[model samples]
Target: MSLRTRLQGRFQLMAAALVTVVQLPPVLWLCWLTRTPLPALAALGVSWPYLKQLQSPWTTTPRAPSTYVALGWWSACLVFDVLMLPALLAIRAGTPADATWGLAGAVALLLGGDAVLGRPRLRRRTVRIAGLPPELDGYRIGQLSDVHCGPHVPEEKVAGWVSRLNGLGLDLVTVTGDLITHGSSHVEAVARALGGLRAKDGAYVSMGNHDYFTDGEQLVRELERNGLHVLRNRGVVVRRGEARLYVAGVDDTWTSRHDLSRALAARPEGSPTVLLAHDPDLFPQAVERGVELTLSGHTHGGQLGVPGIRRLSLARVITEWTAGLYRRGRSWLYVNRGAGTTGPPVRLGAPPELAVITLRRE
Candidate 1:
């Protein structure tokens, strides 16, 4: 077998082992307390199919649409199982088991059901840049990111997003990496799907950490071949009438070298520039460089957020600018929640987004 296949097998085994370690114990403990294996068996039955599906190579096969839903529910079970651990402990201390189980089940059902219902949505944000060129005012840029196209996220899903993007009549399109989950194996297919995207200045992409894991160079080449421009520490001048806007893209800071200075070095002083960097962590660097706007992805808006919490997402733990818009001085940043998922094949409050950013002169 190939090295990748061997690695895949080992990873699957490791994941299965980890899941068992986390999930099997609670079920077993509950069973031991209740003197029955039914609960444990039921939990295993609910989660087994998803674990089985994980063994398959993500890039090699097309998954059934329902596979994502099943996996989402399975993920909810795992999450609730963990969340209920404290209550389970309380059960030993005289708390009622019925109430604990009911609450856990209810929360899990709501969370998982919400994820399945999270349709890809177009979120429109208008950014007012203080130094934005008058001619570039009302410029609509379509931004997409973190399209983890593979088994869990099928081609049809991506095609649908592309169709939506085509309807926007955008001036420019930018995709901020994580194009595929696995590697170069699915690059062509993803390229083909993304090839449908068209804009006035065409589509521009910056590599992400996952893209690096999936063979970054090959991904860049495939995207370029499919007519999507790969911006690797490079700058392009986009013109509208007599107005000029400099667009630059940096390599992923998580897995690759990123030189914001190099990417924006050649741009004329005080000209409006948009920087495409994969991670939002690099927004400070872009701001320092006087980039008018920076676009990023990779957080997926944390994929889960508490319902009543305002502007709170799981991504907040890792990134300050998880989703939507944030401003620093004269520079602005917009984080796209992404079009696809990586691990659980689900999204909770943070739905998949096709962000339409309209630039306005302040």
Candidate 2:
């Protein structure tokens, strides 16, 4: 091979190896950490690095999309270990002990129990939001978030969700990014699946971090082609009779390229505006700009639990307003539990959710 060709091949190999390391090594350590009654010290040693690895989703050479949901389970198992080990160890050892048999037991339960019993659950929520205006009261907006469509996400399930969204009789349907996993891989399929969803105003979306990681622009067009009106750093005014509701969306903040200012730049004055941001962290900017309602779905509401042992899961850290409606002074933020899973395909306390949100002038 020529020198340049050899160099190119080497680059490909390195990239492939890095992806595999990111996706596989922690998983092996996690299995070992939970398989035995490891001490607290060993527990910590095994888990800390796994925690870091979860943030990077690539595994294998060039990160091939697995046909099964094993990675998703693997991801959730690690999260479970993080929450369960510390407490169970503290209880079993009668104090905060080092990685010991007790600690290992807890870690194992988190990893194994969820793997065995956990099922992907979906929740449909409807809320009649009050206190908008006479004209804008009773505006129904269907919200779908975090539909990370790819390998493990059953194709029929996705198409079903879109059908359900359409049945809600919504004035508008909004997606807050994460519509697909490998954005270019199955986003077009997702678009086709969602081709049935129709709302009066339109369908809108904001880009999520995962979408940016994959192919974002193509995903956007695919959704548009499916008749879902997606918005990215843009706004559109919808008129329901005499009422006007300005809907805008901001790109994900974690990817560090979100421009909130631009997203709301075209927001209409004297209109009840709703911001559809993929990540809840953008609420501050929305509140500062006097946005009324902001919808989000990045956190999965502590995806798993041990039934009363842990109050909530570590998924909470991904968003301050993890999985509920919170009012930041004059602005309201509703973080959806999400329509799909990220790493682990299992969900526990926080069920995957779709929302039929209505706006009313209180």
Candidate 3:
């Protein structure tokens, strides 16, 4: 193998090893201790095939088996974490046998409920923005992001999301990015699905970290081919009657391409501006820059959560603004939970969401 190939091989191995290390303890606890044989088999069955594939050198050919296996493992990990609570309790409390059964029953109930409730659905939110033009009041904007379009994410799911957005009669639609999971192989399919979306103003997209992994430039080209505007540090104006609303999009902050100054430079001085950023962490920066409204969707609200308890999301550890709306003074940010899953095909309390934000003049 070439020197570059060797280095890449080592990196992939390190990553696989790290994932195994992170998952091993919890898997063992749920399986061996709790006497949950299914989770243990699932953990090994899914991971072993993918681990074997990783041992092979990287190639252009799609590793569908490995990819699907990895997704199964990720889903298994989610179930294991949920069962851990009862599994631990069963071990420490008397009558371990009964507790083991309880663990299985709880897991089944939770998983079944999650599968039904966690399906991607449309959620409408009204944001009253100060200084919004009177003519622009009650304007609707659709936001979708973090669509990890790969083997696990069905094309029909993408089509359904597009259809829902089109049916909303939205004035504007924004996709914050990560359209595909890893590579540009599925770009055409994603673009085709999104091409069905309709809006009065236009459909615009910003780059995400995953987009960068899949030849960001090519992805941009494909999206533009489907009539979606790929804004990379650029601004556009949407005229509503006599009012001019500015819309700007910066590249993915995770890739260090986010430039608020360049993005805002094209906007007219007094126009109400809406900024599109993939990561919500830039909310403070946008706030400082006097951006009226910002839209984002990177954290997916931990993908797993406890309903009615917002703090239950693991995303809190990374971002204070995990999901929903947050305001700092006159600036507002709405982080969509996203319309798709990433690592796993499953979701818990944090269901896949398509945010329809209606802007009302305050």
How many residue pairs clash in each candidate at the backbone level?
1, 23, 0
Tell me the lDDT of candidate 2. Answer: 0.66
Pitting candidate 1 against candidate 3, the one with the higher TM-score is 3
| Model 2 stretches astray by more than 4 angstroms | 1-131, 305-311
- Lowest lDDT sum, 10 consecutive residues, model 3, at 52-61
Instruction: Show where candidate 1 strays beyond 4 Å.
Output: 1-34, 37-113, 308-312
Q: Write the per-residue lDDT of candidate 2 for residues 1-362, one digit (tens) a residue.
A: 75435534544554344334333544556567688534334434444443443343422112333312335434544454455546555675655445465666565555543433233334444434455667666777888878887765756777788888887688888888777765356767777886677887777777887676456777778778877777778888888777678888887675566788887888777777889898888888888998988998887665554433334655554555767677867688888767787654665556567787777655
Best TM-score goes to which candidate?
3
lDDT of each: 0.78, 0.66, 0.78
> Candidate 3 clashing pairs?
none
As for model 3, its CA RMSD to the true structure in angstroms is 4.7
RMSD of 2: 8.3
lDDT by residue for model 1 (139-185), tens: 99999899988776777888888989989899999999889987556
Query: What CA root-mean-square deviation does each model show from the true structure?
Result: 5.5, 8.3, 4.7
| Worst window of 10 by summed lDDT in candidate 1 | 57-66
